[model samples]
Target: MKVKTLEKLAKDMIDYIINLSGFEHIEDIQLNVVDNLESGDMAECNYNDSHGYIQLNIASNMINDIEQAKYVISHELGHILTREFHTYYVNFVGLDDDDMTSICSNVYEQTAEILAKRLGRLILKLYEQKDK
Candidate 1:
């Protein structure tokens, strides 16, 4: 997919998720494309309370399939919606430095994946309908 198309889909998905979310203090999230991610990593989300915005990364491979794109985007949003990474964001904790924290992040990642696959499909359907 073209960068423009991927960006449009990402923005739409983020807006859809945020509007559905009741978190009032949430700041605007921005989606960016990065070419440097390690192989097989599709995307990642970084949110900061004091810095006031969520930054999302869309890997080069993320644009190949619309469904995959939605999944990657929504998975990141899932982390935000569930407040799964709030501690990491607020305290700047390193997921790799500690064994327990690493394990916890992994658990949350699975939860996010499940939620993302479901919500991602729904968001994709809503977006498709709007375009028609």
Candidate 2:
């Protein structure tokens, strides 16, 4: 699907962050989860400050494809919600990959990732509602 279509889930995810994290003023940025990438589990990413996105490979291993998929979503949300959730990993000690699994992980990132997971669970709570 087009990135433009994710506005609803993105908004719901953001609200999930605020309600679960009890923070406010978190902007509803753009994000997309495409079926791309290979190896390992799911991967989260951000770009252009305007198009914050998470790309997950539907064919990934069960470790990430099933149970841990939320981490990918939450991890990506971690990037948008806080700067500290990822660790800056340079391919050769310089520029970082957009899929910086540990790119900007700070204390705030930890909190945000945790909150993202919590919100993910809540997504199940309101999953049917989103369709209604």
Which sections of candidate 1 miss by over 4 Å?
Answer: 36-40, 49-52, 88-132
Off by over 4 Å in 2: 1-12, 19-28, 38-41, 49-66, 84-132
How many clashes does the backbone of model 1 have? Answer: 0
Query: How many clashes in each structure?
Result: 0, 12
Please report the candidate that would top TM-score against the real structure. Answer: 1
Tens-digit lDDT track for model 1 on 32-119?
8765466557887666566656677777654577877776676676655655456553366445535645666677556556766666
In model 2, what is the error at residue 51, expressed in angstroms?
A: 9.7
lDDT of 2 by residue, 45-88 (tens): 44332233332222223233323443444445545444323223
Per-model lDDT? 0.65, 0.44
How far off is model 1, as Cα RMSD?
3.9
Candidate 2 lands at a TM-score of 0.36
Candidate 1, clashing residue pairs? none
- Write down the worst ten-residue block by lDDT for model 1: 89-98
